[model samples]
Target chain A: MCQLLGMNCATPTDINFSFRGFSQRAGITSDHSDGFGIAFFEDKACRLFVDNQSAVESPIADFIRDYPIKSRNVIAHIRKATQGKINLENSHPFVRELWGRQWIFAHNGDLHQFNPTLTGRFQPVGDTDSELAFCYLLDQLAQRFRQGHPTLQQIFDVLKEIAPKIAEHGTFNFFLSNGQALFSYATTKLHWIVREYPFKHARLIDLDMDIDFSTVTTSEDRVAVITTEPLTNNEIWQAFAPGEMILFKDGKILQQVLTTVQRLEMEKKDPSLVRKTKADPD
Target chain B: MCQLLGMNCATPTDINFSFRGFSQRAGITSDHSDGFGIAFFEDKACRLFVDNQSAVESPIADFIRDYPIKSRNVIAHIRKATQGKINLENSHPFVRELWGRQWIFAHNGDLHQFNPTLTGRFQPVGDTDSELAFCYLLDQLAQRFRQGHPTLQQIFDVLKEIAPKIAEHGTFNFFLSNGQALFSYATTKLHWIVREYPFKHARLIDLDMDIDFSTVTTSEDRVAVITTEPLTNNEIWQAFAPGEMILFKDGKILQQVLTTVQRLEMEKKDPSLVRKTKADPD
Candidate 1:
């Protein structure tokens, strides 16, 4: 098991406050102390930092806490080594280049026998099943749009088709981005919160620290945070139901889809569920 | 133009002492301060740190100087932005994965009209002649060895054949590594120094810093450093001739090759240059 943290913002913002609480799971509040990694996207470029040491003790993590690297899209992970050994190659938040842009991915759950064919250029350097899944996703995307780059909506449609299939093997909660939009899928546990105008004070769940958003943020600033578990106690964290996929861009939801599992269950309960809700067409 | 610094060691060693003086060239000493990056190889995995900020001003660089992350192979670069914008995407050393191993590269010279056909999987993320050359080199290497990875000697042979062709376009001084060995090629300025059992105190040329290798290193340890300019003033550095390529593994030279430019120049002086000296067989 691992923990994931992702952020999408309307403007470049630092995640020191959230990361402080999230890193506690590496050794303090929880036991996910195998390794840790983080990726921050600045336009089409990415800055990735990974280490085999626990985030709580790594000097790199300490530097990250002190350096406020501003980015619009960021993904981070603290690993427990469910599949691969504890090494730099097996650290989470892996990055790859696609369509002349950097893509970052991090997973929070384990999969059983989840091997996929890797016939494309994208290949995992590590032995983690999570990395293999990331490579497979990138390969499928590259296969579908072979000519050049695609729009965000087109990517969302393709990901909606593949997320459920990968989730069928076991738990599959993941966050993916390409310096453009953030796509999050939940099979077991995930939560998200949007902070915008009229921001108030918030306290961390793991640490005895608090922040007054009003003092540091402008009214035009908007931020969306997604994580395996809630980082703050006072915020309105919306829990994702099993088999739910959401696309976040510019700190707002652009699209949402119900997985095959959720759709079938909804169909069994109420045959008119389709008519009651306006599902976005793929 | 930019600057390159690389180190290959028989044992895992920290490079803080050498890096301190090398980083001074980013702004304080020479002024190649558009951006900077460094890569440290831990076995097959790599930890790459890149910033659009100058190393002299970047907080990340300050952290790197303080934290001692030991590695066997390392590459560092400070860019002067000859062809690309000063942004994170254009920072070196660039990294890509092939055959389940991470390859790192950094360049120190300009390439003029150096566009090569890129029909393979490798592509340049940033718009620079340096990165394009790197992609072309990797593409040609992949083409020659399609079934699996080749030995270090085999790679050295292929590089000897391709480096001269690229050097024809413009200056092509560069450093490349795949965590196993360090390969350095010079079309212009490059220098190297090896330190072993008979260690002595060395003084930095750019800073008021000194280090006594006898105090920290064991007699069994050996290290080879390759840089655009010598980082220390007291050490005896060997200068590479124009169009010469050297491969360093385990802190020692494994193979050396003369490019077409060097061979032609040597032939002008002595037509029987090949028979006079023993050249390693391909």
Candidate 2:
């Protein structure tokens, strides 16, 4: 499996501090040292970086520990060997362009027996179930709204419909953005938080680092962070129920829906619950 | 290179909207078709995923779009081959057990020439600059403050001292987290923002989607989002100086420093501003 870190904000900021501690686990603190990658959104585009090396030990990673960049959204990843070879081509936080806008994405999970016949509108550059799903999703989106571009709500509705079908194959957890709002979903483990004014202090569980939020933000500033797990021991991180979907914009959630619209269906077909019973063999 | 997306918040939130637009670029919209990965923080740990496939077409990515795993801190990525082969051993959001905690990391950018001596305190499992640097950084941290544990501020200070030394070698920008606060830095390009209270409506530039944040958050929620670039077009994304370091906790900037304090002196002596000019390679 891999790790994910993301930020969605109302005002422009930088991600230097969080990236520092997160990169350490790539090779220094833990055993995820596979490959690492990150993307920084500027305006409508993004600056992307990737390396086929353990982030903790990468020279580029070292440089990033001190370099500072401020943006409204950012996504990052560090890898562990699973379902693919350790190489640059397989690094995460992929990017693409649609409707003249650049989009970025990352995932941390597996799918079993998920063989979808793609029409080749979007093809995978690497061999992983994650990519196949991404393409399939785009294919669906293109097909569903081919008459014309649909509204955000329209796309959201379709995503809700398609998510479970893909999850039937295996674990699916991911993040997506396009110089706009952030989208994330998890059939298994996923969590998130929003930070605003009157903020308090936070401490990292992996490294000894603390900060006072009151000092750096205005009453107008708000941020939303999502991750696979909690990054701190001091903070109370919330867990997502089995089969849930969420949308974020301006550092706040815009929509949330249960995996199944009906409660009875959730009890028997919730992969999130199954994740707790085991089955993360990637 | 790979792309990254991040979010930090005061209260728990989810990323579903931005991720949808972002993932489109992985293989469907644009072309970061190598692989993808992401992590979500809960309390002191995270669940991570990685795929050696383009996010735009990955089934895992699709599931991520539909599944909603709420998290406070989230990191994600999409990959394009830059170093190493296309394999899972090199996927990111690398994780490590450090100081009895799991640390997650992801990196972007490249290093031209960087090979440092390692004391074997940390080792690299793959042959990429990222792993080497990740290990070296841990070795330095372990050697510097191995006695019990240091404070988060102390850790940031230590990184402040070490970051620029590595940046001199090449472009380094990254995101790091330890299930606590997020640490970010950049030598060339990175950006960030904060959001709170009175959240407004926002739309994705890549995909046709708009989200009204007022409906999803309470008055108590605040968040900070950071990235290598701006994820939304309507929001303002702040750029980092040539060398800057910052700490993010509870969705706000806690500490700001200039890692390359000597950049002025170096610039004075250097005949060419090669470093600055080369940063924007596009």
Candidate 3:
């Protein structure tokens, strides 16, 4: 078991506030104290900081908390090391370059017997099922789109086809980002919240701390935060159904999909349950 | 021009002393301060830290100085940004994964009109001639060895063929490592030194600091350092002849080669100019 955190913002935004609470789960409030990693995307490039040390005690994490790095998309993970040795190579979030864009991935749940045939284009340096799953996803993407770079929608479609298949093995809550957008799928536990205009004060559930978002943010600033567990107690966090995938871009949900199993179950209850939502026009 | 620093060690060693003086070149000692990055390799994977902020003022750099991260192979760069915009993406050293091993590269000199045909396998995230050259080299390697992973000697042979061609355009002094070994090539300026048993005191050229390596290191520890300019004032630093390439592994030179131009120049003076060296057995 691990924890995941992701942020998609309309503007370049820092994750210090959310990360402070999320990292506490690594050692203080929770027992995910194996290793931790975080990636902050600056356009197509990202600065990935990872450590085999627990985030609560890592000097890098301390620097991250002290320094504010703003990014449009960010992904972070704290590991419990279900598989793979606890080392720098096994630390999450794992990063790989695909289609000239840096892709970051982190997983929160374990997968059993999840080895997939790899074409060697994208290979995992670490021996974790999480990294293996990530590499498999990238390998499939590279094979599917052999020509030019795929658009966000095209990638989302491919992921929609692939996530459920990977989830079938076991719990498969994960976050994937390519600087432009963030895609998250949950098979077991995941939650997300959107903070936009008229932002009010929020308090951390793990620590005795609070933030007045309205004081620090402009009205145009919008941010979407996804995590295995809600970081704040005051903010309303929406839980993802057993099989749901969401694509977030510019701090808003661009598209959402349900797994075939969930869709079938929903149709059995009500035909309106299989609903599709379009992106809001900016 | 920028500054480059690299370390290859027989044992995992901390680079605090070298990095302290090397980082000073970013602002205090010299003005290659547009941005900076460093990569510390842990087996086939690495921890890459990059910042658009000058190393002299960057908090990340401060943290690096305060904390010692031990690695067997390390590559670092301080960018002056003659080719690309002064941003995070343009900062060196650049990293890309090939054959499941992370390759780290950093360049000190500028390349003029040096765009090479990319096969879409490895592409530069930023618009830098250095990164373009790196991508070009990886593309060439991927094309040459499509079947399996190439040996260190094979990669060295390929680099000998590719480095001279890229240097024809402009200065191409660079450092590259894949955790197994460190490869360096020089067009204009580069230097290296090896510290082993009977290690003596060395003083930094940039800062008024000195270290007695014999007191801190064991006899089994051997370290080879490569830099744009020698960091120490007392150590004997060997200058790389123009168009010279050297491969270092386990803190010792494994092989060395001179470009045809340099070989011809040396042969004109002495017939025994073309020489080859083999790795020393432990």
Best by TM-score: 3
* Model 1 residue pairs with clashes: none
Q: Alpha carbon lDDT of residue A211, candidate 1? A: 99
Chain A TM-scores, all candidates?
0.91, 0.88, 0.91
Per residue, candidate 2 scores C-alpha lDDT tens digits across B92-184 of: 665543453446667776654456676543444334566556666766877787563567798788788887776665666777777577778
Model 3 chain B worst lDDT window (10 residues): B273-282
Tens digit of per-residue lDDT, candidate 1, span B115-216: 577764677777777777788888898888887679999999999999988776567899999999999999899999999988899999999999999999
For model 3, residues A1-282, the per-residue Cα lDDT tens digits are: 888999999999999999999999989999888888999999999999999889999989888988899999999988786555788888888888877788999987766545578888777777777887898999999889989689999999999999888776568899999899999999889999999999899999988999999999999899999999899988899999988999999999999998852322322344332223211000
Better of 2 and 3 by DockQ: 3
Better of 1 and 2 by TM-score: 1
lDDT of 2 at B156: 88
CAPRI-style docking class of model 2 based on DockQ = incorrect
**Residue pair clashes in candidate 3:** none
Local distance difference test, each candidate = 0.85, 0.69, 0.85
lDDT of 3 by residue, B150-190 (tens): 99999999999998887765688999998999999998899
Q: Name the weakest run of 10 consecutive residues (lDDT summed) in model 1 chain A.
A: A273-282
> What does the lDDT come to for candidate 2?
0.69
Model 2 residue B63 distance off true place after TM-score fit, in angstroms: 36
Better of 2 and 3 by TM-score: 3
Q: What TM-score does candidate 1 reach?
A: 0.91
Model 3, docking class: medium
Candidate 1, true inter-chain contacts retained: 0.57
